[model samples]
Target: MFKAVLSDSNILKTSFDAISSIVDEVQMKADSDGLRLDALDRSHITFVHLEFKSALFDVYQCDEPLKINVDTEELMKVLKRAKSEDIVELTVDEGNFILTFENEARRTFKIRLIDIEYEAPSPPELEYPTEFEIPFSLLKDSIQDISIVSDKIALIVDADKLIASAEGEFGDAKIEYLHGEKITENAKSVFSLEKIKEMLKADKFSETAVLKLGNDMPLNLSLKMVSEEGELTFLLAPRIESEE
Candidate 1:
């Protein structure tokens, strides 16, 4: 038996929104730090790594940091019916799970429990070569522009401009943002459009996005949030090149 109550369900609400689009199933690991999940999308083209502290929830309790695996797609289908301000209650009974959204009215939804086999992916240990601070909102807007053009986007980081471009049947669309002397780079790489779109969904979440680019290697993205409350970081895996 387990019970968790969120002070503002929207935290998990927005979180699941970005994750569900990428991964069908999610393996959530809960411990003293709160609830953490690190899983890649089905195609393995993108990944979502989220960390939610106990303070985010009004009531948080668990036994031995349980690892709960659930079909995120199915759960999201149910959550989509909820309103933003609704208080969400997630509980499990007899190996059966129930989700309740309580606002001025009480709405309880029942979902058929399905068994999911979950495996956690290990993160790399290499020291990131370069790191930069990016405007969160601008980055998201850039993603929208790229998506309208092609399915893939090439990111060229150099001493001059921070570039995001797409080339396809309709020509090419590129956006160059001039930065201050603070940004120092001399390299570039590319990633998929679908991955950028998924990342944009969580754009408004944090103030500045920390981008760590390696030498023609996978890019690491970290979103940092600072409020009067405290600080939080949302880390995401890089999109490595897919072999043909």
Candidate 2:
């Protein structure tokens, strides 16, 4: 048996909104430690990792560790009805997950759990030579600006600066930020602008995002809540450009 309560519903809603676009279904693991989710996109090009510590919840109870597979879209639909100040409670029983939202009025929903054939794959460990931390708004705005002209963006990080640029048939746009201690070494990679935009949905939960990059390697973007209760991490495969 497992039951958890969170004081604010927005945290759960925002988290679901951030990942629903990337994954259709996910397995949520609940234990004494906390709740965790790890899922990869259909194309296997994007991976998302999320963790909610037990301390983050108002109430947390778990006699044993359990894994529950849930349809993310359906869960998001239920969470969408929750008010900002509502207290959200979750419980699992007989293969069904119950979600309750309490404010002036109480609303409860029971969603059936589905059987997921595949287990969550562990993310590969990699060393990134270049790392930097920047405001989430900066990355979001830069992607939006470049998307107007191109479908992909080139991210280049060196000893001095970190730059995002896009080149299209019509024109090119670039945004550069000078590095302090946030960046090191030199690395370059190209990624799908649309995918990155989707991942940025988590920006609402955090003020700054830490980015790690390597030449022709996957990009890792991480965000931690201001309250330091939860975190969202994403790994996106690079788009290899063909030589002319």
Candidate 3:
């Protein structure tokens, strides 16, 4: 048996809004500690991870560790109906994942679970030359600005600034923000602006995002709650530049 309750639904709603855009199905593990899920998109270009500590919930109980498998779209549909003030409860029984919203009225949704052989992938061990924190809004705006010029954006971190630049036949766009963190080395990588934008959909998850970058390496972006009770992380593969 497994059950968890929260006073706020926004966290769960926003997280899945971004996750469903990447993966169709996901397997979440619930234990005495908390609930967590790690999934790689079908194209294998994006890897997403989400976690919530047991302390974050108003009430959490689990007799034994359980795995909940369900379709992302199905879950998102139900979550969309949840209001900000609604109290959310999650549980699983037999072959269905259950969600209940309580407030003025009680609403219940049961989504059938899918059975499949599964193994969550371990996050790849990575060493980044530069890691810094920037506002989530800054990254979102930068990607939107870059999209106007090109589908691909190059992220560069120097001694004191983070720069996003893109080029196109029509025009080129560049945005730079001074990061007050000490950095010893410079690193740059190009990535799909669309992919990064998808991950940024969880803007409400956190005000600031921590970014990790390396020369021609994948991009690591992570968001954590103010109370440090939850975290959502993404690793996106980079685009290789070919010399003409």
Best by TM-score: 3
Between candidates 1 and 3, the lDDT winner: 3
User: Deviation in angstroms for 44 in model 2?
Assistant: 0.5
Sort by TM-score, best first.
3, 2, 1
lDDT of 2 by residue, 24-103 (tens): 99999999999999999999999999999999999999999999899999998998998888899999989798999998
**Per-residue lDDT of model 3, residues 1-244, tens digit only:** 8999999899999999999999999999999999999999988999999999999999999889989999999999999999999999999989899999999999999999997596977778899888999999989999999999999999999998999998899999999999999998999899998888889889899999999999999999999999999999999999999976
Better of 2 and 3 by TM-score: 3
Tens-digit lDDT string for candidate 1 (1-244): 4567865655565667777777788777777667777877666656567777766667877666676677887788887887878888877665555788998998887766666665777555557546677787887878788888887777767765678888778777899976553545465667777666776666445767777665555667776546422222333444455655
Task: Specify the poorest-scoring 10-residue window by lDDT in model 1.
Answer: 228-237
Please list the residue runs of candidate 2 whose C-alpha ends up more than 4 Å from where it truly belongs after superposition: none
Q: After superposition, how far is residue 119 of candidate 3 from its true place, in Å?
A: 1.2
Q: For model 3, how big is the CA root-mean-square deviation?
A: 0.7
Q: Estimate each model's TM-score.
A: 0.82, 0.96, 0.98
Backbone clashes for every candidate come to 0, 0, 0
**Who is ahead in TM-score, 1 or 2?**
2
Compared with the true structure, model 1 gives a TM-score of 0.82
Clashes of 2: 0
